[model samples]
Target chain A: MDIIKKLEWRYAVKKFNADKMLTEEKLEKLKQAFNLTATSYGLQPIKLLVVQNKELQKELVKFSYGQKQVAQASHVLVICIEKQIDQKFIHDYFARVQQIRNTSDEILDPFKGALVESFSKKEREEVRVWATNQAYLALGTLLTVCALEEVDACPMEGFQPTSYDELLGLDKLKLTSVLVLPVGYRSTDDMFATLKKVRRDLNESIIHIP
Target chain B: MDIIKKLEWRYAVKKFNADKMLTEEKLEKLKQAFNLTATSYGLQPIKLLVVQNKELQKELVKFSYGQKQVAQASHVLVICIEKQIDQKFIHDYFARVQQIRNTSDEILDPFKGALVESFSKKEREEVRVWATNQAYLALGTLLTVCALEEVDACPMEGFQPTSYDELLGLDKLKLTSVLVLPVGYRSTDDMFATLKKVRRDLNESIIHIP
Candidate 1:
C-alpha cells in the first residue's frame, strides 16, 4: 500500500537542515501520535522530551557521542521511561482506565491487583527493561509518523543516558532517557540521504508456515 | 495528518472474527513492511514467522495462555531474533551493504569492523536484549501498517516464548520469538471494541523544552 511507499522513502537521516523548523500544527500531530502509541498493558510508562532550544540541543550533542544531528535538527525527541514503576504507577493506570471506561472496580480490581502485585515483586532492573521496551515501541511509532509527514528523523541509541539524565534533569523528573530521535528536514548536502537502503531480501526476513 | 486518524481508528483488538481472512496481496504488504522496518545499526537482526496453519494456531493457543485470539486470527505473526548475533552476522550485513550500494570496501570496512568488534565483545544476554529491542521496533511498525491498511491486529507480548520456540522448532533455525501479533478482523461481539482508550494527557506525556 501507500504505507510501504512512505516506509521506503524514509531513512535514518544523518544530516538535518537546522534552518527549517517544524510548524506548531505538525508538532501537535506528533504529540498526538506519541500519546496514541500502544504500550504494554496500556501502562504508557514512557515520556517524550521535545527539545527546541538551540542552546540545550547543542549541549545534548556532547552526550550523543558528538552526533551533531541532535543539535542540528529542528527538534530532538528524547524518549524516557519512569524511574520508579511501583504500585502507585499501576494504581494510577487502573484509575484512569476505570474513569475513562466507567468500568466497575469489581471488573477491574482482579486485573489491577494482579498487575500491582506482580510488578512490585520484580527487581528494579527487570522493570527498567520492560519499561525500556515500551519506549522502543513508541520510538518506532514516532519514526513512522515522521516518515508519513515527510519529516526527516534519525533514531539514535548511541548517546550516554546517564549524562543525558543529568543535563536534562531527568533524574529529578523520575525519568531516564532510553532513545533519542532528531527530527527535521534533510539537508541538500546529506550524501547519506541518497544512498540506497540496505535491507535483507523478503525471503530472508520472512518465513511462511502455510 | 491522515496517519493520526488511522492511529486513532486502531486499537488492540480483543476478539477477532475467525471467518474473515487477510488476502494474499494485503499479506504481501505486511511482509514488505516488516522487511523495511529500521533496526539498530542497520543490522536487522529480527525475523518474522507467519503461521497460517489452523492446527498450529490451535496448538499455539495453549502456549499463549489460552488467548483465543491466537487461534481465531487468520494468521499469527511471531517476531523473532537471531539466536547468536556475533561478528559473522555483522560481516554478512556489511557485505549486503556493499553489494547494494556498490561502495568500495575502503568505505565500508572501518564502520563494519567497528560494529563487528563491538558486538562481539558484548555478553550474549546483552546481544539478545539489543536484538529483542529491534523486534519491538518492528512490532510497532507492523501495528501502524495494520492500522493504515484497516486490518485488525492484536499486538501481543502475553505469550510463552519458550513454548513457542519449542513448538515452532525455532531452535532448529537458531531463532527465538520475542513478540506475537494476531492479525484479523475484530469480532462484533468484542466489548473492548467500543471502549474509549485510556491514555495519559498530552501535557503529562510530553515535556516541551523551549
Candidate 2:
C-alpha cells in the first residue's frame, strides 16, 4: 500500500489481543527500517530494544501507567539513547566511519576533528538531549514501517523512564528509554478505532508560498 | 512503494536543479501530511514556513552558511518552535482538546491542571528545549512524507537560528527556527546519488527478546 493509505489505516491502537503475534521476519524488517533512519550528522545515537516476554511486558505495563496495550501487544519496542556522548564516543563513531567506508584520516580528518571538538564543548545534558533527538527520528521511521506493514502500534512517552532504565538494567549500559511503542494487531473492541482522526486545519498549521 | 523501498530510493540530495519546482498538488499533500503529524498532549507547538521565492531563498542561503541547496531547492521548509511554553499555551491546548473531543471538565480538569503544573515547574531553558523537541517530531513526519512522495529532501541544522529568526520576523511570533529542510527533485549528476546506504547491523543496533 501507498503511504497515504497506510496512514489512513493506522491509529493509536488502544488494545491488543495477547494471542496474536508478529512473525520474526516482520519484526526483523522493522529493525532494519529503524536502523536506516537518518539523523543529524548521520550519528545514530539510538538503540531499540524489542521486548516480547509476557512477564516483562506485564511488569512494564505498571510502569507505563497500567496501559493494557503494553502488556497485551505482541512486542514493545523501547527506543533508548546513550546517557552521555563523550570524546571517546565521538572518536569511536569516526573510527567506524573510516572502517566501514574504507576512508583514511587524510580524507576524514577535518570533519572528524570538528565533530569531536563541537561535542566536547557541549554540556553533558546537551549531549543527552541531542542523542534523544535522534531517537525520535528513529521512532518516526519505525512508526512508518509499522504502518506500511499493517501492524498496529501506539507511540508512547507517558512511561516512567527513570524506573524503566533500572528495571531493564539499561543503566549499566548507560542507556535510557526515551520512548516505547507497543506493536500488534488492534483489538476490535477499542473505541478509538472508530473515531476519526483529529488534526489542525492545513491552512492554519502550514504557511505556503508559490 | 513500501516505506522501506521509498527510503532506499531516497538520499539527502546535496544539489537541486534550480529551475525545477514542485507542483501545487504535491505541495498541498505535503502540507496536509505535516499538519496531521501527531504530538504529545496533541499540542503542536511548531509551525512550518514553506518558502519558494528565489530572492528570499537567497537571503536564507546566507543564513544557512551559503548552502546552495537552500536557494536551489524548490522550497525550503523552516520548522519553528515556540520560544516559551507558559500557562496560556497550556490552557489554550486543553481548551481546544475539550472543544474538539467534546470532553467535559470533569474528565479533563485534572489533566489540565497537571499539564499546566508540569510546564510551570520546568525551567525556562527546559521549556525551549522541550518545544524544540516537538519541532523535531514535526520534522520527522515531514521527512517521511517527502520520502513517501518521492520528493528529495535534506534535513538540515547547519544554520544560524537567531539571525534567521530576525530576518524572518519570527521573534514577534515568539517562534525560533529549530530546523530547516530543503525539498525538491534531485540533480541526476549529484555524486552521492549512487552510494550504497551505510548503516549499522541489526544485531548491533537492536536487541530482541522472545
Candidate 3:
C-alpha cells in the first residue's frame, strides 16, 4: 500500500457520520496497534479505554469541549497513564521482562535498580510529564493505524481532563486520561474531509546534517 | 503486508550494522512521514535533523551516553522543538492554511485570533511542554513507519540535550533537541533482536466501557 497516499487521505475529521460504525475487525486492529506501541524502556504504562455506549459517548461530549465526534464515532478512545511509576511499577516491568525473556534478575538488577532510584528522585509532576509524553506517542501510532485502515478519527487535546477523569471514573482506576481519539466514519457533508491538508513544506521541516 | 506482523517483528535495536545504509528512497519516506505527522493545532513546531556524517555520528555518541547505536546507525535523527512558539509563529501557520486551502482570513480570523491570544498568555514553560509533546508524537509516527519499512531503530531519551544542541549548532536555529532515534539495520550479534517482546496482557491493557 502507498503509505503517503493514505496519510494524505486522513484529516482531523470535524464531523463524523453517526450512523456509520467501524467493523469489529477494524476496531481490533486499533487495539492491537495501541498495545504494541513502543514506550520508554518498554515499560508500558498506558491503558486504553474504549467507550462504545452511545449514552457514555454523549456524556463525554461536554468533557471533550462539546465536540460532537465523541458521540458520533463508532468508539471513543481514551488514552491514560498510570498514576505512579514507582519502585513496584519498575519491579513488575522487570518481572515481565524476566518472564518473557527468561533473563535472570542478576542481569536485570543494575538497570532495574537504576530505574527505581531514578524514578524515586523524580518529582511527581516530572513523572507525569514523562508518562504523558508516552500517551502522545500512543496517539501518534493510533492515528497512523486509523489512516492506513481508512478509519476516520479526530484527536482532541482541548478537553477538560479533570472532568473526564471524574466522569470516566479514571481516578479510582489510577488512570488519568491524557489524550482522546474518536474514530469511525466521516459525514459526507464534513467539509474538512475534502480540504487540502496544511503542513509546513517538508523541505523546511527536515534538516539533513551531512 | 500484515501490519501486525511488521509491528511484532520490530524491536528497539541496541546495536546496529555499521556497514549497512538506508537507500535514499527509504530515507525520503521517513522524511515524508514526519512532515505528515498530526500535530497539535497543526502548528508543526518541530524539526528533524538527519545526521548521516560518520564523524558527526561518532561525536554524538558521547552526548548520547556512549550508546554505540548513535555512531553505528546509517543516520541519527534528532527531534527538536521550536524554542519560541509566539504569535508570529501562529500567524505564519494560518498563512499556510489560507494559502493551501484557499480559505479566507475572514473565516479563519476568529480561530486564529484565539490561538494568538491563547499563546500570548501562556507561560514559556507551558509552550515548551506543548511543543515537546508534538515532537514526541512525531517520534511515535516515525517509529511506526520504521517498523513497517523494516528499518531497525532505537529511540533514546536518556541523553544530554544541551550537549546535543551545542554539538549540532541547534541554538542558532532556535531548535531545542528533545529526543533521538538511531535508525539502520540491526547487527546479527545484537542478541536483543531475538528476545520475545514484553508487553502487558491486552486484556489488562484495554478497559472497555460499554
Candidate 4:
C-alpha cells in the first residue's frame, strides 16, 4: 500500500497481545530505518534503546504514567539524544567524511572549518536544544517505519524523563530520553482501532500557489 | 517499493536543481500528512507555512544559513510551534476533537479539565518547549511520508530563527519556527546522492534484552 494508506492503517494501539512478538528480521528493519532517518548536519545525535525484557518493560511502565502499552508491547523503543554537542562532535563528523568518502582535504577542509566556526559561536544551550530536535526527527521516522511494516505502535511523551534516565542508566552516557515507542501486535478488541482518523481538511492545512 | 526500500532510496539532498518542481498532488499529500501527524494531548500546537514563491524562498535561504536547497526546492515547509500554550489553545483542541469525533462534553470534559490543570502548572517557557518538541515529531512523520511517496526532502535547522519569525510574520500568530523542511526532487548532479548511509551498528545503536 502507498504511504497515505499506510498512515491510515496505523494508529496508537491501546492494547497489544504479548503472545505475538516481532521476529528478528522485522526488528532489524526498524533499526535500519531509524538509522537512515534524516538529521540536521547528518550528526544523527540520537540513540535507540530497544527493551524486550518483560521485567524492564514493566519497570518503564511506571515512568510512562502507567501506560500499559509499555509493558504489554513486544518491544519498547526509547529514542535518546546526546546531552551535549561539543567541538569534538563537529570535528569527528568531518573526520568521518574525509575517511569514508575519501575526498581530499581541498573539498572537505572549507566545509569542516565553516561548520566548526558556526557551531562554536552558538551558546551551549542552543546546541543541546538543536541536537535534541534532531533526535525527534529520528523518532518520527521510526514511527512511520513501524506503520509501514504493519506493526502496531504508539508514540508516547507522557513519561517522567528524570526517573527514566535513572532507571535506564542514561546519565552515564550523557544521554536523555526524548521519546518512547511501543511496537507490537494490537489486541483484537482495541476500541481506538475502530475510530476514524481525525484531521483538518486539506484546504485548511495546505496553501497552494496555484 | 515498500517503505523500507523508499527510505533506503532517499537521502537528504544537499543541493537542488532550481528548475525542478513537485507536482500539485504530491504537495497535497504532504499537507494531508502534516495535518494527520499526532501531537501531545492532541493539542496540535504546530502550524505549517508552505512557501513556493521564489522570492520568498530566496529570503528563507538566508535564515537557513545559505543552504541552496532551501531556495531551490519546489517549496519550503516551515513548521512553527505556538509561542504560548494558554487556556485558549487547550479549549480549541477539545472543541475540534468534539466536532470531529461527534462526541459529547460529558465524555470530553474530564480530559479537558485534566489538560487545563496540567498546562496551567507548567511554566510558559516549558509549555512552549514541550509544544515545540511535538512539532519535531510531526516534521519527522512528514519526512517519512515524503520518502514513501518518492518525494525528495531535507530536514534543516541551521537557521536564524528570530529573523525567520519576523520575515514569516509568525510573531503575530505567537508561533516561532521550530523546523524548516525543503521538499522537492533531488538534482541529478547532487554529489551527496551517491554516498553510503552512515549509521552506528545495530548492536551498538539498539539494546536487546532477550
Better of 1 and 2 by lDDT: 1
For each candidate, what TM-score against the reference?
0.99, 0.93, 0.99, 0.92
What are the clashing pairs of model 3? none
- Please name the candidate that would achieve the greatest lDDT relative to the true structure: 3
Any idea what lDDT model 2 has?
A: 0.82
Candidate 3 local lDDT, B1-210, one digit each (tens): 877788899898999999999999989999999999999999999999999999999999999899999999999999999997988899999999999998997999999999999999999999999999999888888998898899999999989999999999999999999999999999999999999999988898999988
Tell me the spans in candidate 2 whose CA falls farther than 4 Å from its real position.
none
What is the DockQ score of candidate 1, to 2 decimals? 0.88
**Cα-based lDDT at residue A8, candidate 1:** 90
- Per-candidate RMSD, Å: 1.0, 2.0, 0.8, 2.3
lDDT of 2 by residue, A76-113 (tens): 99999987677787777777777777777987889988
lDDT of 4 at B82: 79
lDDT tens per residue, model 3, A1-210: 877888899899999999998899999999999999999988888899999999989998988878999999989999999997888999999999999889997899999999999889999999999999999999988998888899989999989999989988999999899999999999999988889999999889999999
Q: What is every candidate's C-alpha DockQ against the true complex, given to 2 decimals? A: 0.88, 0.58, 0.89, 0.57
Q: What TM-score would chain B receive for each of the candidates shown?
A: 0.98, 0.96, 0.99, 0.96
* Interface CA RMSD, all predictions: 0.7, 1.9, 0.7, 2.0
CAPRI class of candidate 3: high
Instruction: Using DockQ, give the best candidate's number.
Output: 3
* Model 3 chain A worst lDDT run, 10 consecutive residues: A1-10
Per-residue lDDT over B1-210 for candidate 2, one digit per residue giving the tens place of the 0 to 100 score: 567778778778889987788898778877776676667766788888888888888888888988889998999999888877789988887777776778789988998899999988989988777777777777777787788888889999899999888988888878889899999989988877776666667787897766
Ranking by TM-score: 3, 1, 2, 4
